[model samples]
Target: MVVLSKQTTEQYAYIRHCNKTSAFSSTGIIPVVDLSKPEAKTLIVKACEEFGFFKVINHGVPMEAISKLESEAINFFSLPNNQKEKAGPPNPFGYGNKKIGENGDVGWVEYLLLKNNQDYNSMRLSVFGQTTDKFRNVLNDYICAVRKMGCEILELMAEGLNIEEKNVFSKLLMDKESDSLFRLNHYPPCPEMALDNKNGENLVGFGEHTDPQIISLLRSNNTSGLQICLKDRSWVSVPPDYNSFFINVGDSLQVMTNGRFRSVRHRVLANGFDSRLSMIYFGGPPLSEKIAPLPCLMKENEESLYKEFTWFEYKKSAYASRLADNRLGHFEIFSAS
Candidate 1:
């Protein structure tokens, strides 16, 4: 009835076509935590440092919201192709990107992007905003829950960094508007896998890449295809933990913090016989902050960790290059290196 930890939720989660056990062998493993505990603070920090990854059970957020978002997204996408395509991102970049039919630029997934702020950039794109009443209402409610989670995490991070919660919230994101997009990725069972071998690989959820922003708040259902890389360069899959969304610092955060936090390299593999769903909340700093490194990140050597580039420029280049093959480039121009 309640989604607590990966163990408890596994019993309740609709288990289907789970080769995730195989994924453990296909992809090893990482640490798991319960962030709400006072003791877990150090453990989680150490886990992130050592593994750049971990899982948590009973972290926060409601299971109801997670289920609602997943169910609604599936329902929206299942609509006749024409209707679903109508909601496709019109902007081409931000929200309303296109729905990939067979072989398109973005790999094997379709999405709906939403922004709570009045982004003139998003408006400039020909993409249609969430106009469907049913979809909009459901999405808005779902987003409210996620926003709360993001804010809570930011505050927790402030404590972890020994900074005031207000400082973190003010420095990071403010309200629902700043440029962020949620991608609800659905990887259909491979056609090739079904007809003949029914075991062949055809699904490609997402190619390898670090999130361009500061942090990615991620949650996946029982479907297993997500993997994170280790320092030794092995890929490990973190099976979705119930109620707790896994958090990975992104490239932006690495630069802002002068590499105190590392952005991980991760990829989505193709599923052979089942559909998969994952939701990503890409959160970043306030609009007022420069896209460049913060003074704090550079204080160690009095050297900035990145080239002096605006957020807009970097992301544009990233998208154009499918995220520069996922190896977040070095900040050399102004770096102490």
Candidate 2:
């Protein structure tokens, strides 16, 4: 079994990144909403415009579903090497990896990836399907549940733009297309591989980075590694608020809106103890879709915020950035390069 060190329970509660001084001055609040209500329209719009990230208290996704996904993930990681290997290696698209973060240069974590809106019975079965039927079905169910809720949030973003809900969803999650899918991230504990305190003492949690999709749903176990950059150069910790879901806009939204939205950079620090497992649902359009900036906001000499590119092209570029550090994924293409 992959073991994680034990820290006090007090350590896990929402932690502010207190620098030599205090790290939290800006009060980062995620707007809470009940998507069923008419009032949620304005509330969600305002939330995205102001916070880029927010939490939904009354989203209809069942409490049981979220719990099950987390449990199964832990269970998968717990299995003997043979069962997981059935899924195959971490292919070009990031399916299965036993070495944790060691890609070309593995970090100290391991992960499994699946796309959103993907189909299993078709010509392209998930890389992990070779491993076991139960694994594939369980992951499939989790993706559907998260996407259902993700769609609701996308519709709200459309309302924020005052465009028909279908417009935004089309750009982010093309109808009838099972775009990229679920990524299971596991941060196994690392205690000895420490960096010099001078450069920047080794982080106790995940280094900073942001999701590449429209919305990322994260679940934190007893450990913590989430941090967010403020409008200022400083960064703050994203407290593990189990009662709500953390939603952040991705680079696509930042481009589509022509700068009205921000895809802030965030990351995770290595925890002194406790393995952190998180599942991120990437909402993407089909590789066939053109990823050019939306004309809706591209009018003025408004600084063509991003160059026109296809989803396939964009993801290739993102993978390169992920190589440097998770934070690189948060930067604009030019900056990442």
In order, the Cα lDDT scores of the candidates are: 0.58, 0.59
Write the residue-wise lDDT of candidate 2 on 164-237 in tens digits. Answer: 53556634564666365667777776544332223443343334455555566655565566666756646656
Residue 153 shift from truth in candidate 2, angstroms = 0.7
Q: What's the CA RMSD of model 1 in angstroms? A: 8.0
Query: Each model's TM-score, in the order given?
Result: 0.77, 0.76
Position 76, candidate 2: lDDT: 67
Regions more than 4 Å wrong, model 2: 4-30, 34-39, 93-105, 117-131, 170-174, 191-206, 298-303, 323-337
Q: How many angstroms is residue 105 displaced in model 1 relative to the true structure, after the best TM-score fit?
A: 3.7
Write down the TM-score for model 1: 0.77
